[model samples]
Target: MNPFLLQTEVRLASKLIMPLKLQLRQLSLKRFRLQLRQLKQTLDCT
Candidate 1:
């Protein structure tokens, strides 16, 4: 139960988690772009 050790653990966890969060964000953005493209195509067809 050391404070310094807890801080280090938090920092390490954040470092590891940040990239995964960024990747998830990127994936969602890509998915959104695909949906927009499909919507545009459907609109054009109509």
Candidate 2:
């Protein structure tokens, strides 16, 4: 229950989470772009 230890743990957790969040965001953005491209192609075909 030491405050310093708690702070350190939070800092470490955030450091680990930041990259994962960035990666997830990038993945979702790529997926969205792919879907958009597919939609445009379908529209063009019609």
Candidate 3:
């Protein structure tokens, strides 16, 4: 395998992965916030 081709493949894979990682992080944060809100509501009710 050619070194240049391998390098390009790695760069492309990283470019694709960066946004996916960011989206996952954002989704997890949203879920965490939702959980905290639910917890607060339950505490208030109790």
TM-score of 3: 0.97
In candidate 3, position 23 carries an lDDT of 100
Q: Candidate 3 lDDT, tens digit per residue, 1-46?
A: 9999999999999999999999999999999999999999999999
| Candidate 3 global lDDT | 1.00
- Report every candidate's CA lDDT: 1.00, 1.00, 1.00
* Candidate 2 residue lDDT tens string, 1-46: 9999999999999999999999999999999999999999999999
Candidate 1 ranges with C-alpha deviation above 4 Å = none
The model with the greater TM-score, 1 or 2, is: 2
**Pairs of residues at least 3 apart in sequence or in different chains that clash in candidate 2:** none
| Candidate 1 per-residue lDDT over residues 1-46, each given as its tens digit | 9999999999999999999999999999999999999999999999
Better of 2 and 3 by TM-score: 2
Weakest ten-residue segment in model 3 by summed lDDT: 37-46
